[model samples]
Target: MAIHELAVNAVKYGALSSPEGHVTVVWHVEDRDGAQCLRIEWTETGIPVIAHAPRRSGFGTELLTQTVPYQLRGTSTLTFKPGGLQCIIELPAKGVLQ
Candidate 1:
């Protein structure tokens, strides 16, 4: 659901809006602060330019910033770079991993 929202936004107003733009999604398990975590990085590149972050928070922003951290006890960050946007999400990987 989180990832889907990202893709939706990307297609509507992000790098995906541009003909030459691209989006990359990657994930891995790693240790953070002595705890194992599943880190997912969503990156957008090849955008012509990005003026700045959105002026207001949307449902996607609330989900990433509030819901994920509060409900899943994870962490997330949304960054607007010169060329595109980058979102990093880290979720606890305790019993979920085998």
Candidate 2:
């Protein structure tokens, strides 16, 4: 549940972190191998990136992997870019949310 994680982060360490800190979540779809794949990106502008990977077990990470692919029948990949984290989840074109 990205929505849930976003909410939690907003309350804990996201937009509310400071007046200048902000987070953006976006998604789109494209055709790949005759199927539609969902590409989602999460960008945090003001948070510091102290580690290369998640420090502890967390629901956000778990949900990002499990819920998106298993539940939605998709494939997902994540990358830590220069500015923020990017996640791309690919699902069957049929029955997807968008």
What TM-score would every model get versus the actual structure? Answer: 0.89, 0.70
lDDT of 1 by residue, 1-98 (tens): 68889999989888799998999999999988899999999999877768688789999999999988888888999999878889999999986578
List, residue by residue over 2-95, the lDDT tens digit for candidate 2. Answer: 6577557655754446666667778788888887766766666655542355557477768877887678887666555443455555667687
Worst 10 residues of 2 by lDDT: 46-55
Off by over 4 Å in 2: 49-51, 78-83
Clashes of 1: 0
lDDT of 2 at 14: 47
lDDT of 1 at 3: 86
